[model samples]
Target: MISIRSVGKTYRSRHGEVVDALDDVSLDVREKEFVSIVGPSGCGKSTLLKIIAGLVPASGGEVTIRGRPVREPFPDVGFVFQNAVLLPWRTVLDNVMFSIEMLGLPGNDYRARARDLIELAGLAGFERKYPWELSGGMQQRVALCRALVHDPSVLLMDEPFGALDAMTREEMGLELLRIWEERPKTIFFVTHSIPEAILLADRVVVMTPRPGRLARVLDIALDRPRAVEMEFDPRFKAYSEEIRALIFRPRRERVH
Candidate 1:
């Protein structure tokens, strides 16, 4: 569903130095594939994602969705940033329904569907509450609902659950799997958590440090409809270690 070919990104710092974030990064995400990206802190994983979302342009190479260059954010794309970014004053239902409203669709048209999403995301009773009124997990669930409310073809998630407590993070992870089962979309998730990536992805793309580049793509042979219980399995541990080793290994210094 997405193709990133030889994509590179550079930023001009205030010091007038050109800094490379990503260098010749190439990857392909097939239709309905759930791929996670893992790397060192400054490895440009987020930069790569923004490029695919068309929020940031690459200095060289290209990112295309279905053969079309990603010149701008596609309507079929849904982005979930690190935070929920919900309007504090809006109710949960209204927050989920906001995108539809922006498209100028009548509220009546999406009311039923929005309600279903709220329920699906386990936020049915909290619909009338404000963002601050809900717990962190609940708010993130609402954020997930908001992103999928429009039924976008691709979901771009950038560490959506990185801020929550461990228990809440685990619960949210399971909830995400449930939602993915009911309504599957091509998901490109950027995360620092090794276990999270293994549990959620069909394939994990390991990246090197800046100037970031693809290091390896490992397929999760683990069976799907994967439950949190699978995390305790020995095979899951193996997968986690493999990815961890790949991500932390030193990279050859980039020659200017």
Candidate 2:
């Protein structure tokens, strides 16, 4: 489980202007729960994830995983960025194994595990290939395998599929769901796509614009093994409309 409390982040420009990125954002993620954060560009969705991952420090408040404060990158956490970020020179298998190498875990022990993860991500024979040799979707799948190769308890993904085409993005969404179902982990995914968030998460955390704050958290009561057809369901439409309103409604209307 994870808990984030009253967390805020601020950045100072060289010109001495202070820009607040996040403001008093708080949320809790239960074990093996899939939570997605959706917000406008620069709404601090990614910043919140970095704070939890300890890639960057929060200017105020705190973030903890299973009660321990996260002051630095924890071994139990895995990260996937918007890009694959693979070492172009390394083969796919080598890239996945990179986690073990970086973490100083037993490489011999995890080599088999790495191979299994590649297969799970549907990149079985592609392990011998390089990032440049694969399609964008395939490259992202490689990134996903690398994140899970070490078997981290928590996966932090930041717009992992944002670069792909619509069709590939949808396919990756389904691919991610399948992998999650087969091997559940506490996943916190950040994205700009509302539909992608709704399709993938058990709960969608909506955030306000600049100096982002939690606007609403909607529980997705959709059934398991969600198919693309479910998007046509009346309940899905209602959830989408409600979220759209929360994000796009006039500021005066949102004031409570």
Report lDDT per candidate: 0.88, 0.93
Considering every candidate listed, which one attains the maximal lDDT?
2
Pairs clashing within candidate 1: none
Candidate 2's residue-wise lDDT over 94-173, tens digit each? 99999899999999999999999899888889989999999999999999999998889999999999999999999999
User: Each prediction's TM-score against the native?
Assistant: 0.95, 0.98
Cα lDDT for residue 98, candidate 1: 91
Q: For residues 77-144, what per-residue lDDT tens digits would candidate 1 score against the true structure?
A: 98999988889989999999998887677889888889999998878788899999998888898889
- Leading candidate by TM-score: 2
Model 1 residue runs over 4 Å out of place are: 252-256
Error of 2 at 51 (Å): 0.1
